[model samples]
Target: MTLTIRPAVPGDEAEILRLVQALADYEREPDAVKATAESLSATLFGEPARVWAHLAELDGKAVGLALWFLTYSTWTGKPTLYLEDLFVAESARGSGAGLALFRALAEAARGLGCGRIDWAVLDWNEKAKGFYSHIGAKPTTGWEAWRLEGEALDAL
Candidate 1:
């Protein structure tokens, strides 16, 4: 039950990819994950824009990860922490790993003077929705999430 959360390093790429794919599978969108170790290494550690990650370890084994990046909230006029993905291994669920990951993100937001921390969950994932509610996160019912991917994404 003891968990340790820390920023990821280049050596953690494979583990991070595993966790990310697991998350995609859980969301019923297995094909959505296109990241490879080489690409992940380059994007996360390379130039242009840097993506960051935090890994959660239980009993010294990686059990979960949170991939995130910084974003600006024009309305708030401050930076925000955008949690791109959060995943806990099936065996690690209910062991407080998820909450620990969330707290770690919140702590980072606080340290950076971030105006907010934002993420989205599938509507059908009742368990996840309930957990977020239990943690006092309200769903933004007024907003609809939109995305452009594949050809459309590339066209732009």
Candidate 2:
């Protein structure tokens, strides 16, 4: 079970989108995925690209994905790596692919001079939360996630 994690390149958009859709399904929001391969390609492989991703493979078969972007931290006076998504196919859950992907992401954050890494996990996902705890990640307290989009954004 050879596990490998590497930065995604052009032409990997289809695989990326597939993994993203799989993630959405796992999150019980199967219809919430609005991304397409074209969009992923444009955003991730275009000139002046900002979003990035890492693909994890087990024995040469794609099994996981880690997508992220850099955000500026006013307090830290440095960049922070915000992980947009991390998903491992159910069959690959215990194959160390998830941890390997995180290791790669952490290595990237350090190489890019990021002050920290941040991500959100669903409140109902005990398995994910436990895994995060095992990784020494502490949940942010005293704050809740907020979002505004679609009609609300247009009204604003």
Candidate 3:
């Protein structure tokens, strides 16, 4: 099967949401996803879209997704592509879809003159870590992932 990666367009919300939920499940956060097709459409296709996504298809069948957003990096003095999620369907695990998605992201970064690409992998996902290493991606050694969401975010 031939695999292709392309930027998601307005009508892809359903497929994108499907891949996102699958990703949440893979990350052991099955119940954490609250995005609906409408929400995804608003975020990904609404005016001044804050996030972006790419879909990976094999012979016209959607099989993976790479969701990301841009962030400024003071150190690099340029925008950075922050990958929010990367997932390939269980049946397509070893079909190169993941790498194709990543390659597409890299191409996008290069085109946008982004300083770098960044993502976090769960510590327990050794397979993902290995794939990242194989792709020449090194984990950041000095920072811990932190979050201040929900009530804490609202309080602040």
What are the lDDT figures for the candidates, one per model?
0.90, 0.95, 0.94
Error of 2 at 63 (Å): 0.4
Using Cα atoms with residue i matched to residue i, what is each candidate's TM-score against the true structure?
Answer: 0.93, 0.98, 0.97
- Model 3: worst 10 consecutive residues (lDDT sum): 20-29
Q: What is the lDDT of residue 102 in candidate 2?
A: 90
Q: What TM-score does prediction 1 earn? A: 0.93
Full-model lDDT, candidate 1: 0.90
Candidate 3: tens digits of C-alpha lDDT, residues 7-102: 999999989999999988888899999999999998898998989999999999899999999999999999999999999999998999999999
| lDDT tens digits by residue: candidate 1, 1-156 | 679999888788899999999998999999998889999998788876478889999988999999999999999999999989989999999989989999999999999899999899887999988888898888877889998988999999
Candidate 1 regions off by >4 Å? none
Ranking by TM-score: 2, 3, 1
Clashes of 2: 0
Candidate 3 Cα deviation (angstroms), residue 116: 0.4
lDDT of 3: 0.94
